[model samples]
Target: METIAFFNLKGGVGKTTSAVNIAWHAANEGIPTLLWDLDPQGAASWLLDSKAKSKAQPKKILNGKTPIGNLVKPTNYQHLDIIPADFSIRDLEQQLQLQSEQGQRNLIAKLIEPFSENYALIILDCPPSFSLLSEQIFDTADALYLPLIPTHLSLRTFEQTRDFFKKNKLKPKRLHAFFTMVDRRRSLHRLMLAHPPKMLKNGLPTPIPYAAVVERMGDHQAPLPAFDRNAHVSKAYASLWQDIKATLSDF
Candidate 1:
């Protein structure tokens, strides 16, 4: 199965929203898919209403004498499943630090293997941080999708993230950027759309406009198209997903 980790070091860039929409579209196409809520905030888990329970204190599943599949939970989506996140993941990070120092850990990768057999795609919704957890995520992901806004600050963070990865000698290929929360009324948004910087133009263009319907996704407990197929946001997501499918098939 191909794993796409939707990640960005800076938060509030609609990373989780993009991840949810793309994964939902894949499952709608009858592809067996799973969205891994790797973000400690559990936003993705909350969106999908997954029931996976995590304790406030996470014992290293790798260090523990139990199989990892037990921690997984299925979601309500037909072909889309999810392994929910625990709100207490901040503590999990602290515990992971001890494991990282030992240089003998690959827990998330090992734990995720079972799903590969059944899923056509696995989307990981990661938190906005440059930590060991994020490192492990990059190590396991087959691809990475970065949701970025058309702003100077976002690009700055993107540059730093790239430099950091290069310094660590880990080349995260398949890193693509897409514009989000775009307001065509604004001159800045218009400029970015008309002539996207090299850093933001590595991927296809099917910009998701700033639409209200996307927010209703959570209330409807479904994707944009599933909730309101006629919505502008739904159509935008459809076009983007179509491009992604074409790219994958060619690959």
Candidate 2:
């Protein structure tokens, strides 16, 4: 499976929404897709109408006490399954640290490897932070997709991600980025889009517009496309998914 993570060091950047929408699009294309919500907040799970509680603690899976297969739960959509997040995931970093010493972060990779061929794509909706758990995600993923706001601070965080990869000797394979919540009326937003940051290898061609329809995802409890396929934001996500698939081909 092509494992891609939607992540940002800073929160409120539309990471979870983008992950959910993109996974829907992938499944709609007849590709078996799995959305793994790694955020402790459980926003993705709730968005898919799944219960917020999970019987299996993600910590156990990370500690090698439970099988990763047991964590898989089918969502309402066809060919789309979710490994929902639980509150116990808040201790994921501590669990990893306790399981092994330094440089033994392959536990996540080992967990995911067995099921690599079972699905066409795996989307990880990661928590917002720079932590030990994030390091493990970097170890497990084939690509990292950062949903950033068009701002100077967001550019700084993107730089930090690049620096972390360099310091850890990780190849930035398929490192893709796109701007979320873009307000074209704002001069700063327009200027940032006009003069793209050098840190992004190939910026996604479409920017998710700042719209109330996007924010109403919580009320709909489904992907933007599922409710209104013709909505501007939904169409944007569909186009974004196409761009993402093309980038993943390079991997």
- In order, the Cα lDDT scores of the candidates are 0.76, 0.84
Worst 10 residues of 1 by lDDT: 54-63
Off-target runs (Cα >4 Å) in candidate 2 are 52-54, 57-60, 102-105
Alpha-carbon shift of residue 41 in model 1 (angstroms): 1.6
For 52-83, candidate 2 gives per-residue lDDT tens digits of: 44477666676678878788888889999888
TM-scores of all predicted structures:
0.89, 0.93
Query: RMSDs, each prediction?
Result: 2.4, 1.9
Q: Which candidate gets the maximum TM-score versus the true structure?
A: 2
Q: Which candidate leads the pack in lDDT? A: 2
In model 1, state the lDDT of residue 166.
74
